[model samples]
Target: MSNINLKTPVDPKDAYVLVVEDNVSNFVLIARLLAFMGVQKCEWKTTGWGVVDFANTMSRVDLILMDLRLPHEDGYEALKQIRTDPHLQNTLVVVVTAHGSSAEMHKAREAGFDGFLSKPLDADRFPEQIKQILNGEPVWDLGI
Candidate 1:
């Protein structure tokens, strides 16, 4: 992965993030953003099923950037599996999708997402949103 810095004053290398998006463009965008944020440790999974498998193999996963709509399985189902898994139950998951709505946000919350971000995600605010999640803040509102 090419080195990119997304954070202004923060170094994200110390942090680890897993981005689960089926869309290649979206995955690239997320990976770039994380790199820009100074996140040196970032992994990618193209499907919900892949995410489950990856999570099982990973020793430490700090955060998960999950796409709401995906082939094979949706984010909701994947979230359910993650939450139910004894080992991964505590992993923080942030739902990322273009289908942003009050209902969807509520559903995400119900599914136990740690946070939510609308698609076409603002690169400018991406770092802050990540920081907020890491700080144990729930960013249910896109206004964050």
Candidate 2:
């Protein structure tokens, strides 16, 4: 993992971020990135069903970085269910996927994603991107 500095660091230890991804390598990379950002309360779920189940047990979550494709249910359904749930509604959920075309972004937006970040994330800018999203700025970095 690479050490990327945050220009305006937000104590990541104070936040709870849930990562929903099926790919182990992707999860590892994201987990490492979150760790490097100083995030201590990070959780992982391998499937969409797992995330929903995990969220039911979690009292608070600051953000959710979810993959569009998964083993069982897709990210879209998971996100929709999460958003509708009174317990998890206000939590920030962003789609982190390889499909970053204009149409895909539009679809994600329509699906009520707080943000959308392209896959093979830019390690150099990831910290800032996450910070921006946490700060109420919608990140749409297509990695273009």
Candidate 3:
């Protein structure tokens, strides 16, 4: 069984987060932002493929930020695997897609994403969104 540290529940500074995105630039920006916010634990996955298996190897995962359009499998498929996992049931998964349309957002919400954020993510506001998510608050910004 994977060990999880809950002394600081949902606190970004103490949380382990996974980012599933194919774009390196996007991932770098997100990692930097999280680092700036004092988040020390972070993981990266380029595709939704085997995401669940990958997550299983982690000692703990407080949150998952995923992108829809990927190289192989898509975010929805990965999300399905994550949602079905008993271990990751409480792990927050947010959709961070470039197609930040109303339709896509609605689809993500319906598909069971805990939160949604449109891409071309604003550096200034991204940290706040992450903070809210870490604090058990929902952020469904389309970046409009």
Candidate 4:
């Protein structure tokens, strides 16, 4: 994991964020924003199939930004697996996707996402939102 020194509203330097996104551009954008938010350790995975293995390798993870639509396994299925895993059951898993319809959000909630942040996240407020979620607050900003 690489370290960054960007100023943010909150100190998320200790936070470890894993972004499960198949799209390279989207992942880059999210990683850049997280770095800008002072998040020191940010990892990426292109498919949902690797999520469990990745989680198994990590001792602890602060958050997971899961894209609802993935190549092999969908985000919902991945979330179910993650929730069932003893090691990662309590980890924060937020749905980060472009599908921000109310119905989609509801389904994501029912599928057990800790929070929901729509795509094209507001750069100015992303850090604050993440900070709140890290502090045990449920954030549901669909941005619709």
Highest-scoring model, lDDT: 3
Q: Which stretches of model 3 miss by more than 4 angstroms?
A: 1-9
lDDT tens readout by residue for model 4, 1-144: 111112232347888888999999999988988898789888898989979899778766778999989999989989888888887877888999998988998888777788899988888888888888777677899785
Tens-place lDDT digits, model 3, residues 1-144: 212223344777988999999999999999999999999999999999999899999998889999999878999999888888998866888999999999998888888888899989999999989988877777889999
Please, what is the TM-score per model? 0.87, 0.90, 0.93, 0.89
- Greater lDDT among 1 and 4 belongs to 4
- The superposed Cα distance between candidate 1 and the true structure at residue 81, in angstroms, equals 0.9
Q: Which ten residues in a row have the lowest lDDT in candidate 2?
A: 1-10
Which stretches in model 2 have alpha-carbon errors above 4 Å?
Answer: 1-10
Decreasing lDDT order of the candidates: 3, 4, 2, 1
**How much lDDT does candidate 2 score?**
0.82
Tell me the RMSD of model 2 versus the true structure. 6.1
> How many residue pairs clash (N, CA or C atoms closer than 3 angstroms) in each of the candidate models, in the order given?
6, 0, 0, 0
Give the poorly placed runs of model 1, Cα more than 4 Å off.
1-11
Indicate which candidate wins on TM-score.
3
Residue lDDT tens for model 2, 49-122: 75766987876778899999888888998987887787787778888998888899888888888888999998
